[model samples]
Target: MLLYSSVGKLSAATCSGVAKNITLAIVLPRYNTAYPWAWPRVGPAIDLAIKRINHDPNLLPGYSLCYVFESSEDDSGYCSDSIAPLVAIDLKFTHNPSAFIGPGCHYTCAPVGRFTSHWKVPMITAGASAYGFQEQKTTYSFLTRTGPTAKKLGEFAVHVHRFFSWTKQALMIYDDKKSDNRHCYFTTEGLFYELQKDNITLIHLPFQENAEDLDYQQLVQMIRMTGRKTTMQAGIAFLLPKRGEGGKEGKNELKKGKEEEIWRHFPRTVQTKNLTLAVVLPRYNTAYPWAWPRVGPAIDLAFEKINQDPNLLRGYILHYVFESSEDDTGNCSDSIAPLVAVDLKFAHNPSAFIGPGCDYTSAPVARFTSHWKVPLITAAASANGFYQQKTTYSFMTRTGPTQNKLGEFLIHLHQFFNWNRHALLVYVDEKIDDRPCYFVAEGVYEQLKTVNISVLDTVFQEKEGNVDFHHLLQQIKSKGRSE
Candidate 1:
């Protein structure tokens, strides 16, 4: 959820009638040396970025960029959400900053986000990555995330588990009882939920710091015993060790020295003889593009060629079943797509999926395929949202250009023409429709915002039976758009 707000002209002016530099209050855990987010690590990067932004004549045109740093004071190692916001509040009133760009810890960023939203101030950060931040629209409406969130980590974990065909695992979380932010616990909450949703047997273990009464050796022995039993019963035992001791170092040592131990646990078996591929599309319908006549024959030919080659899929024979994504109206239906996917999954136990090619239809079906750990390949569903493979559109592979790429092309074209100001006109159909223009316009608008292009006005026209070009033209004219 990346959001950037343009800094407007300030009322105050210099004696020479020059506008003052726009100030951004940076709130970070600068004083906290225990964490990597401390000033010594991230401050130099921020300084360099600000210098580049100020130097760029193409961005923010008349206005200069400046910033002041305020320590959020996460001195206790874990970020204090409450303390961070109070610091922001002080800076907000004192500096009257145009925007904010810090509080880089997820725990600290969230509270400050709530304040910024209410104040109608934009806040940019590389943190606040916990899963909750993705859905809390009202609370973090003014907040912009410059980095990937924990939700992607959760989805990637699920993807990795499915990729390895692993059915069981153990996750270890560190519980810092004295700290306000339990970084490990909050970050992996989404991962635990995903594993549970997949019906995978997940053993969750949490240990507190400096618990002298707890027997460390006995705990390790218990886990080792469990690993042996799990291997015998489930044919796999996966354990994620804690940091500093048996984490990266242990895994590296196992890879180097314990090759025989790993091989004994994971014995090689014969490849699966058959794998089903579910090909979903508007098989008989021609209401939209990508009808079965257009794409089905090509898919069939490709599969036939692959199946004929003995070395392609080793000894496994690829089989495919066709399912229609069209509804009674002869159009691709989002509702029907998932039902067909579920039916195909149950009947064939497919290893992969293809088509349900329409953008609306493919999205919902993609979610199901991602959860089932099945790859969904399509030349359609070219919306910008599908680019988010680690989150909503996990397991989806696009074999064609996406709207985001189109937006990028448009941006380059605009830059070439030196078009800084323009009016955006989007035509949305009033009746039941695919909303092609709305999706394209949305992607273009977001892309334009990143480069600080001035959009004079956005006009949305609902097209019904009779098109009114006069009114739309008049509306755009009223905005006095030059480009």
Candidate 2:
């Protein structure tokens, strides 16, 4: 599931010389937490594309492209059939939309595409990549896919299988059998079906995707028990004699042996003391871009490189213990992060904290690291407070840009363009701890106000699902801005 770029260009090409009042019903998920390509993350880029297309004289000739957004997701961050169909019906009657840009999730996309295909209206999406979409041609005849499909993924997996020459495979998948939550099931169904054609024994192990009471121990035991007879088990176990610094049998063990002849080639004086770094992250199963599966290997590689170098941190060896700040549902908790920090502090005596990458989760962990006088390094935690509250998070070090820097950059942008006035629409869900847009809007507002730019109005949306687009549009209409 990758978000393809040049959405504006694609949209422009789709709606070229369509009509004067050409409106596209743009369906998007409200939050980016669960999916990175959600509307909150990609909405601005889409808006900018529309803006550029509208302003360009040669592009559309006389026709100007416009969009009406319909947030496709419900409160739990899954696309809702109940919400989307109603919204689509309303948009169809009210806006008289020329086309449908998206309803990215397979759940919403399926129904919406049915409507569009019947209406002879073209609907293009960067999501809805399930293989079912490919098979259901008549239902989705007018639908256009702009992203990777599960069919291609299945083909890719087949290639991998052939390359490995594996005769048997255990296909462990997070398969939720619910209507809205069957993304994993749909994605893997292609692979499962494709593998059935091959000459290999495959075991499909389906589990609850996000159940809070999910039995992890049972899952582990099940993995061990499944296809145990056929799978070859190979591992190396180290047997260290009681001849260490604190060992009681050290004198006796020392008398029994000298270094082996093969050991003479290596430097025995290399650092032996282990320095533990607490590696906090979201769960590996979450499929987030920064989750443990993506980040853990990088951390291990870095530690490997550092520990291999004899001069780097000369007296100590580098190691890490991974801890998840998020649960199965993908919600990062402030409390969980601190608890992880306290546990790692005592258990591993960690020299530093590597993450808790979420902005909300990073706060408590940062405070803990600051109190412990150990550095908290992260590529995330880009909110304004992290940079502003220097005294509170003095030991916190960011490897990337903060909201303040973004605010500063926006200020320069406004100044360079000589933009005087603009309206601000800030979405802050009090229910959700991750309010990235709110923080960014705050920073942008502060910076823009400093230069005496006329603030027409600042609209605050408390809920993503409950945003009154009609009221917002009315406010803009009342402000007398035609653009």
Candidate 3:
């Protein structure tokens, strides 16, 4: 399960200047079941995201976020008996919420659908990814989701099948409990049709083959006496919640709402085959501040294309999981690369490491973790000479151009403006236990020298980012150089 909790400090804060706060109702459902949540920190993660948005004045323009955590009883599959009553009773109707978030379980979304549809309130959920909710849009007029959809899940399933080169498999549905069976029913339909189009044979069942180990040797020896069957090379089980809730009226009425309206829209296609993609958000990379968030969608787009055509990646499916990376200078909390890699190794066991973005953090991961076995793949991290020391750092690979390539860029810029002499500004912080402060400066100087650029002088700052360039500007003027 994804267990990281994100930045959610100011989720309920009212901006200092904003007189009125926009309220959102957060509905976290407590499903009475044995299966643990895929990500136990879903609630905190949402709060953290909300806090991030609230603090960014440019994002919302005129809003301070106010939200109430509403825990509703959704034990039974029937919505009216559990969810509907609690939503009506728990939520403050007078101070109308601008929107409602969550009801994470697939079954709980039904009541939110009814309420949101009736009041025309916008609803957002991070989970509850059942398929076919879009067909009944009138009831789910204002719903959204930040996670994957039923069709995407189906496509992902197809990708898994394609990855294994398996033409035959069992499709397990959770129809044992009527209320809890909605997800299984929808998943079965959605995936059945998708796989059916691909000419894959699918047998529907209500449970996993490993439900018990009662198989006898004689039964296997007879080629399955009941019927002639090809080997079931894979099994795709839909393990969704089911407690059997709501009567015919609930299904016909409130269940019409879907998570599709909440957010996230992607063009869908089924790709063949499967493989795992692991990524670490480069949050600690001081050089590229905007890199972290883009990784998620970038992975999405890559897989989207691969999945669109079964033949695009003929024999494999691509799956991606990303974890936040950090160091002392704010990459991600408690995420010093080496330790984080160890945790990930035991927990998720990624096939490869996508990145920590910057060289400082990526260096440790490649040097230590990748050497342990998993390869490290990165789009950035052009600094710190991994390419020059290729044999020494054999496991590290760059998807991006080298840092020396920047000299070519500098040469282009120099040619464009007819610039000649350059003065280098380097950050000097000799505070570490024993290491030298001018780590990046030496490399920068060498790259410039390699490109035949003449350096007029090299100036030093007390720290990397604490430069007061006004004094340096005066000295530059004394030297009478502009470039």
Question: What are the lDDT figures for the candidates, one per model?
Answer: 0.62, 0.63, 0.52
The Cα RMSD in angstroms, rounded to one decimal, for candidate 2 relative to the true structure is 30.6
- Once fitted onto the true fold, the runs of candidate 3 whose alpha carbons sit more than 4 angstroms away are 1-18, 30-56, 73-81, 88-92, 157-175, 178-189, 196-483
Model 2: which residue pairs collide?
Answer: none
TM-score of 2: 0.41
What is the TM-score (0 to 1) of candidate 1? 0.42
TM-scores for every predicted model: 0.42, 0.41, 0.36
Please rank every candidate by TM-score, starting with the best.
1, 2, 3
Among residues 3 or more apart in sequence or in different chains, the pairs in candidate 1 whose N, CA or C atoms overlap within 3 Å are 27-103
Candidate 1 runs further than 4 Å off: 1-272, 458-483
lDDT of 1 by residue, 293-312 (tens): 78866866776777777677
Estimate, for each residue in 1-483, the C-alpha lDDT of model 2 and write its tens digit.
Answer: 112222233233234465575788877776744765587777878888988887888887788787777667766767764455546655666667899877877767766776676567899888877766776566577999999886787678677778877656565554223555354555555565556567656653444435455686886676566643222112211111111111010111101122111100112354367677887877654454467778776876777788779788888777777677764356665535554565567667778888888887787678657755799998889888787778668899999767888878977877887767767543323445466677777777676677887656533434446567888777666553332
Cα shift from native, residue 14, model 3 (Å): 5.0
Q: How would you encode candidate 3's per-residue C-alpha lDDT over 1-483 as one tens digit per residue?
A: 111122143234344465357777666543433322222345556567768888787877677776765444433422222343244323535356788776655656654555565567788776556654444455456777677666676677678888878676553333233445355555555565567668887653332233343343543443344323322222334433222122111122212222011122234336433465566654434445435656666667777787667676666666666555543344332113433454455555667777766665565566544335578887766664676667446777788765556655666776687766667653323332112224345445566666577765534435436566887777566553473
Error of model 3, residue 364, in angstroms: 56
TM-score of 3: 0.36
Instruction: Name the lDDT value of residue 189 in candidate 2.
Output: 57
Residue 303's lDDT in candidate 2: 73
